[model samples]
Target: MGLPMPGDSLGDALAHAATLLLEASSVDDTLDAIVRSAAASVPGADHVGVTLAHADGRMEALAATSDLARELAAVQESIGEGPCTFDPDTAGIVHVPDLWHDERWPAFAEVAAQRGIRSKIGVRLYGDSASQAGLSIYSARPNGLDEESVQIADVFAAQAALAMGKARVIDELHDGLRTRQRIGIALGILMHRYSMSEERAFAFLTRASSHGNVKLRDVAAGVVADFVAGLEQPGGG
Candidate 1:
């Protein structure tokens, strides 16, 4: 979808963004689309970045529209302080009207200013038990982003989060299907080799997985590999 025109209502703009983001085919594509749409829609957003923060304190930049945006995210990750590094549960949106004068994150602000970023806004995207996300908008002029910009960004953040969550669910479903297929192949191999029933083959796989302290999928994969190896032996087939 294209950027919203002048005098367009916030609802209309967000609806368009949601439609564009939901059309993304993968998690990476969803993230890229979110950043690109944000740059086009959020006011004074010269650069945009999406950051994921894990409960274990790891921060990563998932997508960025420019090198400057990526650099700022890296600085936050290195210093362990910045709008993108804040606790999503306890903090509200962060707005830096002038990075040079902002004191909340001196190290981050210093680095941002050095990179020619004068203003910034950070909005929480989504938060769950294990991880959360933040959207960072950067501008080249002081006071470039105002309250209205924050309001606009908040809407975009919600749309981006929804898109990301949906993409993750899709990935999980695809992974589940692959795991089941691999396990089925392994079970077939075991049933054929030992003349065992399906239940007995599954139990055998379970025992091997527990004894080896390996995941069931990994254990199943090993069984399939062994069967293939035996087939390749001299006069084995």
Candidate 2:
């Protein structure tokens, strides 16, 4: 659904957008909601995109409202220019009111203009020394975005950052629980099969993990798989 009408106060629209963002069920869903909300709420925002930069120097196009947005994000990543490539911690907001005349990012502006995108804006969503994220809005007309659009986008970016951070934490918690359960099951299996105590069974798994240079969870999963495979053999159960 669209955000509150322009006649309504910006505060009211931001409140509504925040509710929608919080209702997202996963990280992907949250990114999608943020882009959709920005497209609907920000004036002159013809398309929107979200890009996440990981600590390992990986760049991901998390979400986009249109192919144009995705293409623009790719251009920014490949050329290492444009607002999306800015340091999120320092460049909280970057605006290109007219792409054709903008010289700050000549290569980026050339590519954008070729794609019929005349204006663009990027708002920092979240950032740390190792990783960062930003939202990009594209327009087809020169001077398409204004200060009002920037203000509205800032609110949306803030809400988006909070939603994304919470989603990541929830995901990490779920992964942790799953890993613990798998390790526990593997320990039980080892203890029963080798007539060893719980501590010894765990130590065995740890040693195997260290020796093989594999993750503990992966080692545990392999043990569980072997047990299941053995059980499936004739007269093995």
Candidate 3:
């Protein structure tokens, strides 16, 4: 009925953050809330960072406002490992008081330190049940984030993990649908080009996928693309 009294205390702030996490309806919204809450929970935090990794270990930044933070995020992505790529054995609260001294991510730390980022705190966004999300807060001030900030991040991580999981599921389904659509289109092209039945075209694509050690949809798409491109050549239909 009433907001908790405005205070900087960790307990109060965590309660507020927990409430925010509970209210999130989507992964993007949950991440927005998490970042806002991270900045709120910390003492000198000026910005918050969020990232999601593809199945290929390519990390993509979800949200970051500052230019330097965005660049640093891109660097981590290019390297494929950084503070966000922490050991699963880590119990909780992976804290880096100073990026310069953190040897674990030597390249990432060098790049980040040069970018004027002094500290970072990363919490595992996904637990043992799922793997895709990762949360990290980047700070420009030296040794900025405190213990309370880590706890707040961890709590937010757990609460929003459900939404993150849902997003992953939805994303997978969308990708599958797209793959099927592409495969079907490619199969149709093959059928027309080869004067073969749909069933036979599909079988050819499947056999090619298995023989080439490539995905079925990929093989189909490549075949169709090549066939179409041939038709575009001189004296071709």
Residues 74-165, candidate 1, lDDT per residue (tens digit)? 88888988888847465658899999888889998888888889999988887777777889899999999988899999888888888898
lDDT of 3: 0.71
Clashes of each: 0, 0, 0
Give per-residue CA lDDT, model 2, range 98-203, as digits (tens): 9999888999899999989998888888888777788989889998998888888887898899999998888889899999999999999999999999999999
Estimate the TM-score of every prediction.
Answer: 0.87, 0.89, 0.62
lDDT for each residue of candidate 3 in 1-237, tens digit (9 for 90 to 100)? 122234746678767776776666556666677677766665656667776655555666776545565576678778876876534565556788888777888998888888788888876676443334567777787787767666666776675565566655666787899899999898888888789999998899889989999998789779778877888999887
Can you rank all candidates by lDDT, best first?
1, 2, 3
Best by lDDT: 1
**Clashing pairs for predicted structure model 1, backbone only:** none
Candidate 2 lDDT score relative to the true structure: 0.86
Worst 10 residues of 2 by lDDT: 1-10
Range of the 10 consecutive residues with the lowest summed lDDT in candidate 3? 1-10
| Model 3 TM-score on a 0 to 1 scale | 0.62
Task: Mark the regions of model 2 whose C-alpha exceeds 4 Å error after superposition.
Answer: 1-9, 54-58, 86-89, 231-237
Report the error of model 1 at residue 26, Å. 3.0
Cα lDDT, all candidates: 0.86, 0.86, 0.71
Total backbone collisions, model 3: 0
